[model samples]
Target: MKKSLETQTQLVSLNETLINELSSLKQVIDESNKKMADKMDITANALITSNGSLAESLTKAIANELNSQNRKMFGQMQKIENLTVESMSKLSSRVASDQTLSKVAGNQQVLAKRMDGLATQNQEILKQMEIS
Candidate 1:
């Protein structure tokens, strides 16, 4: 009986040691899980911040490109407008000169008619003087 009691006590002590080891393992697993969760959170936050910065950079680049294109387009439009105005001015000047030329031609026709009339009168006068 004494030997049996001693064996039983030894078995009980072995079971207690096993229970303590299991508890210690459980605590270590919990701490590892917590550390993994913290790392994941930190990684998620970093990804979010990086994505936000990338989006901002893309937006600014697009806006700058649009502004540059707009400026170029505006300059082209102004050049076209200036060309149109210059062509119109030249056409107006040509039209005025054409009108002036027409007026001068009409005056020349009137002067020719008067000269022809005077030549006819001089011929008649010369015929009368020859007969006298």
Candidate 2:
């Protein structure tokens, strides 16, 4: 009978130890869950911040590229305009020179015709032996 009482006491002690171990395990699991939650929050915040920075940088780069293209286009347009104006000026001057040349050529033709008539008259006079 005393041995049976000793067995009962041992069983009760084992059960208490098991209960204590389970409570300790529960506390460890709760602490692990809290740490995991904290880590997840930290990671989430970092991602948000990184994304925001990347978006801002992307926007800024695009704006800068557009501005650069606009400036380049304006420069090209100015160059084209200057070239057009220069070509137009040269064309106008060439046209004026051509008109002057045509006027001179017409005068030269009239003079040549008069000289030919004079030569014909001189030849006829020579044939009559008026002037050797």
Candidate 3:
């Protein structure tokens, strides 16, 4: 009966030791998980920072490209405007020349009619004189 009591005491002591070891292991596991969590947070923050910088750079690049295209379009528009003005000037000059030519042609027709009338009057005068 004394041996049985001693056995029970030893079993109780071993159970306490097992409990302490399990507690220690749980603390170690919790510490490891916390460290891992901190590392993941740091990595995520770095990625976010990198992404922000990349977005800014990409936006600047797109804006610059658009600005360059706009400048080119403006230049082309100016050129087209100048060309249109030149074409209009040339057309106006041509129209003035055509009008002057038309005026000269009308004057020539009037002169021809006057010459025909003078010839008819001279023929009539010649006929009268010859008969007399």
Best by lDDT: 3
lDDT of 3 at 70: 100
- Residue clash pairs of candidate 2: none
TM-score attained by model 1: 0.72
Please write out the lDDT profile of model 1 over residues 74-112, one tens digit for every residue: 999999999999999999998998998999999989988
Clashes of each: 0, 0, 0
Kindly report which residue stretches of model 2 are placed more than 4 angstroms away from their true locations once superposed.
1-5, 115-132
| CA deviation > 4 Å runs, candidate 1 | 1-22, 128-132
lDDT of 3 by residue, 1-132 (tens): 999999999999999998999999999999999999999999999999999999999999999999999999999999999999999999999999999999999999999999999999999999999999
Please list all clashing residue pairs in model 1, or write none if there are none: none
In candidate 2, position 104 carries an lDDT of 94
Candidate 3 TM-score to native: 0.74
Measured with C-alpha atoms, the lDDT of residue 34 in candidate 2 is 100
TM-score of each: 0.72, 0.72, 0.74
Q: Model 3 scores what on Cα lDDT?
A: 0.97
Best by TM-score: 3
